[model samples]
Target chain A: MLNIKNLKVSVENKLILNDLNLKINPGEVHAIMGPNGSGKSTLANVLSGKKGYEIQGEILFDELNINDISVEERAQKGIFLAFQYPVEIPGVNTNVFLRTSLNSIRKSKGEKELDTLTFLKLIKEKAKELGIDEKFLSRQLNVGFSGGEKKKNEILQMKLLQPKLSILDETDSGLDIDALKIVADGVNSYKKKDNAFLIITHYQRLLDYIKPDFIHVLSKGKIVKTGSAELALELEKSGYKNL
Target chain B: MKNQNLNINQEYKYGFTTDIESIKAPKGLSEESIKFISNIKKEPSWMLDWRLKAFKRLKTLKEPNWQKPKYPKIDYQDLYYYSAPKSSSNKPKSLDEIDPKIIETYKKLGIPLVEQQRLNGIAVDAVFDSVSVATTFKEELTKKGIIFCSISEAIQKHPELVKKYIGSVIPLSDHYFATLNSAVFTDGSFVYIPPNTRCPMELSTYFRINASETGQFERTLIIADKGSYVSYLEGCTAPMRDENQLHAANVELIALDDAEIKYSTVQNWYPGDKDGVGGIYNFVTKRGICKGKNSKISWTQVETGSAITWKYPSCILQGDNSVGEFYSIAITNNHQKADTGTKMIHLGKNTKSKIISKGISAGFADNTYRGLVDINEKATNSRNYTQCDSLLMGNKCGAHTVPYIKNKNSTSTIEHEATTTKINEEQLYYCNQRGLDQEEAVSLIVNGFCKEVLQQLPMEFAVEAQKLVAISLEGSVG
Candidate 1:
């Protein structure tokens, strides 16, 4: 469902992602483990079509070269990226933003839009499953939210959008153990046979719950090794020094 | 893309005028013309004497040079002082009896005088040129002890009240335009709310300029007695003309002890074309005075259309514990220029004032926010806060702020903050990424910029103003 061939990306004349290649199919979960300055976040940003990036090489999504598509178009094509730091959009209620984003995606997919009642019901159900307080949805998006709460919000957006390819960039960085479990469980619950995920992390603890099907080691803007779920544990035991 | 062509002639919507013969004074400003206007209205001797005094004062007063607009020297002697459509000797008893041409002019301006089911509840006093056509809801307001009528009628029916407070707040020699307005002004709305009486409905006055080569000089006065409250709204529009037209109006308000007066203006004069060919020169003076303890006064304006607008609606906080506020959103697009703001004078102890101004400049337009906050020596513990922000859409346009804060009292506190920013390229990119076109993105960002001031309007007007902001910014983006 996703393919990156020798993806080279630069921002402001600084090469951030150089000759990076990766691939993932439907119904599979892949974890990319890298240390600081390993271009993990840069790869995620390039895939989401963020501006100020100069790219060379091809990025194909479902057999279409999507390097020129806008971020919103990528989102409508079932591509979601949970930000490392969620932006605070004051005066825009979370529920309204979610509903707008949801309806926008649905309209792009030629699906009927949900009215207020059905939208509320859907939000309530997702809030219950994610253990999120219902009141948070009515407040401004990401405003005054704690680190863990913002991570949970990203997961909430993923659940509502139901993107086919979800990329979690450093989603578990600042979360406590209990928060990690809640966020990991939120991701685990959304696993389906027709969707894929690329989970990027520096710690092996989140992998204990998510259980990736394949593991790739990234360093210096390139994938150095490809292994299975056990590879995350090996890195935890020996650290990236041995790799 | 198909909707782009629909707005090609959008500026021409207000370009047509009704064809009617008018009784016009010879083009010029002189003592004779002022006397002619007073005699035509059949004013009392004292009124004529007052007009003569104002006419002399206007001669010595030089045209103001503080506003941020440039134009050919105004030929005061080249303008017709009084131009009114000839009507029957008897006043029209109902809307149907009014001339159809007058009604059609109002209809084109979206303010039809002929009452429809939707307009049954709204009280409208439609003013054309120098006379009031019809005043609806007069009986209802009269039952509530409210006197809402034309200034000419008020001069005859309630001369004592008019004499007591005609130029009490803004004197005849306040400014060049005010002096000119005092000299040859024909008619406008006169509202008087008795003590402790709350007006039952909103009072509105619509001004339209129709005659060619005629300058509209109207005067509006509103007085809220002690412990009374009232809200007044004013709107203006004019047909397009190849030559620039002059409009100089003066509006004054007086609020006594514990009285509150809310005045709002939505000025949409005919802004010139893209090349800045011909439009209206809107120069006006509006001021309110808090004369008694604990009085409150606020001025809110949304200025979207004008070729060159030079006005500053101000307030004077004279009584102890009085409050004054000014909330303004001024947009200048396509060769429009606006130099507008407010003045708050703190004279009494513990008085407070606030000013929030938002200016948007686009399409080679120049918009300026010039304001003053003065605290007198006797105003102990007085406080003032001002926030002025400007947003520039394109590089060719200009936005500037000139604030003067003068405090004579050591115990008074005044805070002034101003910011000039261009539209966020990233925010625009984000909205465009979400499938909104460039114009929609610009509108959304502009709305967010003016959100602080727009929220101060009444609920229904807030919505309408938001839509107006969008319409004004249409085609502004390249």
Candidate 2:
């Protein structure tokens, strides 16, 4: 349900994503493995419609061009990007943000809004499943949250939003093994036949739990190779130098 | 949730006047006018003498020019010194006896003085025009040996207390407004909590200016004796008029050893029409003194209305281990101009102070957050943290921050931070993408902007203030 055709993007007049191309269909998980400067996170940001980007190519979501949509509109269109570095908003509680985002998406879909009690129940259940402490819901979003906790919060938002397309940008970074498993499990539990994911990572470890239907090697903002899940193992055995 | 069902044709809900005609001096400020006011109030000879001295100072004291927005020089002589609606033929013995129009005005304002006493368990000293109309729950407070009444009544009942503490912190010559207020001030609330006595209820003063040309100059003094505690609330509103009204008032608080005083003000004076033609020029001077050791004082204000507002409720922390705090949320909409903040002076050892101010400027309005925190040499180990945040709604409006910090003690720690930002487009887009309108998104973001200060208000006032913030920003977005 996502397509990119020779997408060339630049930020602040500096070319970040050169001629990049990728595609993913529903019910499929795609992983993009790249070195530090391969423009992996930049690609994720451009897809989420973050401001200050110069794009020369087309990006399509469900057959609609989405390069001009706002961040929130992208969210309503069922496109979620878990940030590598979460933004900290003091005095804005996590639960409030999640509920607001969920209700916002629901409203855009012409769905009924959930009352406070119902929203609380849903959040409580999802938070527990994600092993998120109840107190974290009342604290300001990402304020003073540890690295792992912020990543887990991103997953929690994804589960509650239940977006059709999820883009994870190095969600496993800074997380311990246990936190990595919890975060992966949260993403795994939200997987559905009608939804898709574009997971970006530097290591092959996350692929152990979240198996990818297709693997693409990205270098210098271009996809150099495309293969099956086994291609992740090959990359792990030999670094990008051998590619 | 009392909704104000306003009649479409009503000039303004609080615009109604009492039939009890007031004895007013001719509009103008002269030595004669000052003397007329003091004589009309039947002040003590010494007080009249004090008024004369203040009149002299008023002449020499130039009108402050540093505040935002410029206006014609105040035609002191052209403004009525005192104006009150004629009193009821028979003074209202209770809430029911008061004028129905007056009661309705309070109801529309959500103060429901009588209902608040019966349902919400709050005591209200409702001041209409220049006179104290009714003070509810006085008997219960008197039983606790607390003196809560009009300043006029206090002078007669508790002369010693009023005589000793009035103008102790804010002298008559402290500022031009203070001098003006000192000379013509007619009536305001006076509270004296005796030593070791905790006030039984939250004392509130609601000042409403009803007369057309009458300028409201009321003075409030609250004294919390040793080991005593009291929380006082001040609120004001005026009738909408084409001619701008002047409201210059003085408030003084004194906290003795181990005493604590909490003062809150929600000033919603008629802010004129959207074009800012005629609204109350609210220039007030309010300060508190921590006299004895361990005394604490806090000033919390939500200033949402006024054509031009220049007020700074401050505190002087004198005694050892004393504390002072100022929390405020000032919103300026349309053509309103507000330059308000606070001053905290720490004089004793281990004293602490905090100032949190939020200014929201919308339309063509200008809002400024100005504050000062000074730590004296004797105030070792003193600490202060000040955070001032301003939000601009449109490009036409302005938000400015001016903070002055003076620390003389080596052991003191003072941190001041300020940030000015326009409402985030991303945040708004995010909210709208979810289906909420732009106004709702702006309200949510603005509410979050002032959340730190709003949380400091009493629960009931917090909700009201939050709603006011949204309403004030209603037409701000394009």
Best by TM-score: 1
TM-score of chain A of each: 0.98, 0.97
DockQ value of candidate 2:
0.17
Backbone clash tally for model 2?
12
* Fraction of the reference Cα-Cα interface contacts (below 8 Å) that each candidate reproduces: 0.06, 0.26
User: Which residue pairs of candidate 1 clash?
Assistant: none
lDDT of 2 by residue, B1-478 (tens): 1112212121323444444455567667777777766665566777777778888888889888887667778877778877654553233567777777777777776775774445665678878777777788888898999988888777767778877988788897888889888888878999989999988767888999887788888989999999999988878877778889889889999999999999988888888887788998998899999999999999999998889999889989999999999999999988899999999999989999999999989889999888889999989999999999988887999998888889999999999988998887656644543334556567777877787888877676787777777776775775
Error of 2 at B335 (Å): 5.2
lDDT of 2 by residue, A1-243 (tens): 999998998888888888998888999999999899989988888888766789998999999988777666677788888878776656666777777678877887889988879999999999999999999999987779999999999898888888899999999888899999998899889889999999999999999999889999999888999999999999888889876
Candidate 2: residue B394 lDDT (0-100): 76
What would the per-residue lDDT of candidate 1 be over residues B123-227, giving only the tens digit for each residue? 677788877777778888898788988787788788898899988888988888899999999888999999999987778888988888889988888999999
